[model samples]
Target: MQNGRKQIAVWDVFVRLFHWCLLAAVLISFYTTKTDGAPFLFPIEVHAQAGYIIIGLLIFRVIWGVLGPTYARFSTFVYGPKNTASYAKALLKRQEPRYASHNPLGGWMVVLLLLSLSFQAVSGLFLSDDIFFQGPLYGLLGRDVSGELASLHALNSDLLLILIGIHLVGIVVHALLGEHLVPAMVTGIKRFTSAPVDEKPAYRTKYRLLAIGAFLVAAGVCGWLWFYPY
Candidate 1:
């Protein structure tokens, strides 16, 4: 409540941490796998480790989206085709309304990113470099199937870069439209001069402990896959 604006806690602690941690993991994965002549210190093993971290993060996020606070749920942000189209039209006309959670188009982007990253991580589990590195489930699918997944994994990495580019461009476009979107994600608090009409009461559920519990479960599962591989 500064200067007549209402400040609300939109992203929870787990969500904020998840967002940044995922970003870092993605970057590390890409740098280790995609870049040529990269540091010898960061080998393909680092890439595999980052993929495991991403798998754990995505698992926790799916759980949180189901059971976390009001604004964190998929129901709050995932709009349908008509709504997304309408929001796109509004955006082109510069008439889109501000949203406390993700705007309609942004919601779909989040879904796409999640799905894409999930595929990337899961596919990596079947990949191998004949000489030194092998994913946990590298030989489970047989060489032929693993080879196909390896190809898809490479293709999807390009798609991921494209999607990430669009995401960054969207942030810049929002900034140009007078909405500073990144800061809210960083702080987990969003401020508005007038609460958006669609904005719901924030933090209606006590999910902090539940979120932590969910992450531990996710991490344990991913850890088992990382260690056991069978």
Candidate 2:
């Protein structure tokens, strides 16, 4: 608490960990895929491993969205189409409200990012480059079908890159408007100019075991799926 404001814990430890871990995995996968085993000391297999890890992370995120803390839950932030449009209009006019959780536009952005990444990961499962690598599900489909899925995987990767650029731009815009979003994401605490009296205190971060269990389950599933075909 400082300067007539109050500090509230908005993100829990699991949420913060997921955010950073996903970011690192996505960046590593992107770099490895783009370079195609060149310019990096690590083998290209790291790229496929990163993609598998991302699938696990996505599974964890979906479960967390259902059972995680207040602000981390989808019900707490997702808004309807009309409400999102209104918020976008307000944002364009520089009159948007300060939300304790994710704002309407940001909430939808989160959904889009998740969906896009999910598509990319699922498609990657069927992709085969015919040389050095083959996805786990490649043999489950015909060559033609797998080839199409590989194309879709590449296309969606580009789309994800574009979405990532937009996400960064939004962060910069919010920062310029005096919102310290990055810090809040990092520290799990949000500082408000004047705390809302009606806002309930955040639930305690007591789901450490649940998060770890979910991660282990997700990792196990990924591992089995990756190796079972061989």
lDDT of 1 by residue, 1-230 (tens): 89998888888778899999999999998888767626756478778888999999999999999988888899999998998899999999998888989999888889999999999999998988887678888888799999999899999999999999999999999888877788988998888888774688778546768987998999997897678643
**For residues 128-215, what per-residue lDDT tens digits would candidate 2 score against the true structure?**
7777678888868888888888788889888999999989999999899888899999998888887632255677648777788888
Residue 134 of model 2 has an lDDT of 80
Model 2 Cα shift for residue 178 (angstroms): 0.9
For each candidate, give its TM-score against the true structure. 0.94, 0.92
Candidate 1 at 31: error in angstroms? 0.6
Task: List the global CA lDDT of all models.
Answer: 0.87, 0.83
Off by over 4 Å in 2: 36-42, 196-198, 225-229
Best by lDDT: 1
